[model samples]
Target: MFELIGIPPQALFGQLLLGLINGSFYALLSLGLAVIFGMLNVINFAHGALYMLGAFVAWFLLQYLGLGYWWALVLSPVAVGAVGIVIEKTMLQRLYKLDHLYGLLFTFGLALILEGIFKHFYGVSGQSYTTPDLFKGGTNLGFMFLPYYRGWVVVLSIAVCAATWYAIEKTRLGSYLRAATENPRLVQSFGINVPVMITLTYGFGVALAGLAGVMAAPIYSVNPLMGSNLIIVVFAVVVIGGMGSIFGAVVSGYLLGLLEGLTKVFMPEAANIVVFVIMVVVLLLRPAGLFGRER
Candidate 1:
């Protein structure tokens, strides 16, 4: 393979795995963004910060309380969601009446503050998370030796993405959510509590980010800046996938990951920018995104 493309198949698959792992983060993060935007119409620029916060919260839990990954998996989301609730009640709630940009700007500023504070204390150097003992090793297949953690991330991300899609698309709660978001007056007249639903929806969105962060903590360094670049890629992914479609976001995310992987094998230099290029092409082809309904 390297004879022809100047890259070995092993290296290619490794990058592909990297892309897929990155895509998992993108899918999870974007799903949260989509969920928040789908119902609340607020672009949560604080999502990235929230993700980083989750990792720190997990780290603190482990370091201070001797909690393990299982506990972090359970506790981190709750902590992050609490902060999200505070943010929503104190700041984001006020901007709902204004232009959508206000929410975005406010959240963006909040992200900067949160990230800056964490950096001030933790600095740019990231801390390491020990991989769980159960997921510590790799599996040898004929083609490649698959790292257990990477494989777990991909599988778990897909499961989560699928579950979210089903909940939003199939369940009664999802029906109310969609109805409320589409027309709060009508939904309220129908006796659903739109305000509470909106709050939970936001919490759910932030919780998803928290979960992603915890999953990421072991794989990547626990750093304040982790969310910054990842969030940008995820935003591009959401834009390309059609913000309205949960399933679309998941599928596009994984697909782009594979594509990025292939690019590394065939064209090394273009690998980094391939996702953005795809986003551009996607936007050109469908301004509303692949699954988005035209307004």
Candidate 2:
């Protein structure tokens, strides 16, 4: 078999597939961050905790309510999203007039509180979530074996990302959202409810995180720390992609994921820091990010 850089094709393909899967999660989470920051102007440090909540909610549904994977996929996001609505109305809405640091600090404290509560009740140990029977096997793809669930994750994530991009970039509602972000007072003068829109936008961004949590539950050990571990990487992605640039967030997410995967194969010792390294380089070269428009 032909080899690239002395690595076997199987190993290379396997790592690439793994990278793509990781990238999907990054894209989803960062997309949410971008959306929230764009319209609500909040950093949403509690996003990771909300993601953890989504996974726990799914587990609870199955454990106590006799629901299954499919049900969790549909309900978890909605439940978590409702929680987001409450948080926005009662807590986040009050911080809009202050410096952005206030929003960041508030959400950071919220994240800590949420994680602490979960740790108190569930402990630090991870819980297992079974893959649905529908995605129970793997298919041979010449060089590597692709698990059905992983493939589903990749496909579904791409579909969701694409759909979100279209909705925000190409639709009339999206135009209104963009306009509101640019000038809430002007939009409000037109009789549009800007405050409610801000609230809903925050909820929607968090719902994306909840959706990703459901997708991740079957693959990762569902734990309080899972989202926290991934969230930092996602924040790096958002920074590299540009704070409020939707397209930048999605593209840079997958790009960095693949870069990280390649680094693992080439320089295993640097795998963890590769994404940040690239982020530093990108910032030096184009501070506005690859897809971000300069203000």
Among all candidates shown, the one with the greatest lDDT: 2
- How badly does each model clash, as a count of residue pairs? 0, 0
Per-residue lDDT of model 2, residues 1-295, tens digit only = 4365788878888888889988999999999999999888899999999999999999999999989999999899999899999999998999999999999999999999999999989988888999999999999998788999999999999999999999999998898899999999999999999889888899999999999999999999889998899889999999899889999999988988888888898899998898888889988999987777777
Q: How far off is residue 66 in model 2, in Å?
A: 0.9
RMSD of each: 1.7, 1.4
Which pairs of residues clash in candidate 1, taking residues 3 or more apart in a chain or in different chains? none
Error of 2 at 133 (Å): 0.4
Please give the range of 10 consecutive residues that has the lowest summed lDDT in model 1.
1-10
TM-scores of the models, in the order given: 0.95, 0.97
What lDDT score goes with residue 59 in model 1? 92
lDDT of each: 0.87, 0.91
